[model samples]
Target: MSESIEMTAKAPVRSAPAPRRTTPAPRRRSTRRGPLHPATWAPTTVLVLILGLIWSAIAAEHPYILPELSEVGLALVDRPEVFLTNAWTTLSIALAGVACGAGTAFVLALVMSEVPVVRRALMPLAVVLNVTPVVALAPGLVLAFGFGMTPKVVVTAIITFFPVLINVTTGLRAVPPSVLHVFETLHASRTEVLWRARILYGLPYTFAALRVVMPLSIVGAVVAEFVAAGSTGGLGTMIRNAASTARLESVYAAIACLAAMGVLMLALVTAVERRVLFWHESQRRAST
Candidate 1:
């Protein structure tokens, strides 16, 4: 009986299943896509290509109409003195005008922020000034300021002011609720809140508005020169000379110079923006 019981146990043990082997689970990979930002060179690249094609076509037919890029380049190189002097004159006026306009706008925007009643009073007045038409008003400005930089500067300031005012006001109003709440919790005074919070927050917008106004101010200065004509040797005067003499090429060259000036001024403003507001979203976008 003992031997039979032992045999039964051994037989059950022998029939038991073999040890099961377990396999490790497969690892999963993350399939997230990276940032899909556009490149800065894309637009400039396309513009250059289009300009080159147009230039080439012009060069092929009516070569005079399509002055050789090389010719224009040579003209730039050969008589840089004329271009540089005229550019300097125009730029000085433009900078002066920008200063006046920006200062006035800053003060006005601050005042408006503090006194909404003043804003309501001044807004319609500003609109009347803005839509009064530059060509018609420019002659009157020249008549008042007497055919010198004074008139040009005044015209430029007039044309340039509204943009700065609008932008600065908008910026002053952009103070975030969270920031305001923080100020309140700290028991900050109204002046402190404005100087520390509102102005700081509005800086980017102020710069953006200046970027727009700077170019327009240039146009304004040039227009004033047109009205004050025959006494000045500005780019505007150069245009008149070319027009009177029927030198279309020279006129085109002057126009090109004006374009270059606008580009340079705008570029400088953009650089300032990048430096001053490196943390701002706009700067990040421009960089990308």
Candidate 2:
């Protein structure tokens, strides 16, 4: 009986299966990172300093051609009202032109992106317009529109439209096939596809173009005003008058005003980009 009990216990112990060993799971990485420091601004700071130094050197060497920064400052202070009024006029015209041009470009780009035939027809026209020199057309526009702000605005629009059109069209077509397949399976309508997929997908590129287009539009407006030669109320006209009268410092002041306007426009576009394309990689990195 003792041998039988012992044998039974041994048999049961040997027959039991071993416990399965479990491997531990790997650690997951955290996606969080810290904000950008002041060092992030280093490149822009260096560029500004370099530009200032070069400008100072040029002003010191050629007092007649390039007025001293201090002289330009004095000119700005001496006639603040004139500067403000002229600058306001220039801003008004430039902003108007940009708004109109951007709107038109957006509609045309949407159409072209969806319809391959339209894209084939319009893309060549866009390229030709882009390659056409603004200087050559500005004079003709002024002659046709009779030296008014109308002509200047049209000239600015013509100069700025191509970039917006090209960039937005490129972006609209850039939606991935995988994403489009999802939409297709869901049976989304054409308007839904455009609004939910294409336009939203293209938002970053549109804003990117805006960043370039806004300042260039301002420059175009000012240049057109200079060519038109009848207006005394904008920065371009002020610069022309100052140059003709040999007031180099005043001309420099007008140039400074133009630069300030360009900077403001660029800043505004950047702000809008952050707000509108906040989901984009560029903005995401910037925010982080």
lDDT of each: 0.82, 0.86
Query: In model 2, which residue pairs have backbone atoms overlapping below 3 Å?
Result: none
lDDT of 2 by residue, 130-226 (tens): 8988778877776788866888888788878998998999889989999899999999988898999998889888888999999998798888787
In candidate 2, position 68 carries an lDDT of: 80
lDDT of 1 at 25: 86
lDDT of 1 at 287: 55
How many clashing residue pairs appear in each of the predictions shown? Answer: 0, 0
| Error of model 2, residue 62, in angstroms | 3.0
Once fitted onto the true fold, the runs of candidate 2 whose alpha carbons sit more than 4 angstroms away are 1-37, 40-54
Question: Residues 85-189, candidate 1, lDDT per residue (tens digit)?
Answer: 887787778788888978898899999999999999998998898898777876777677776687777777888999999999999999999999999999999
Clashing pairs in 1: none
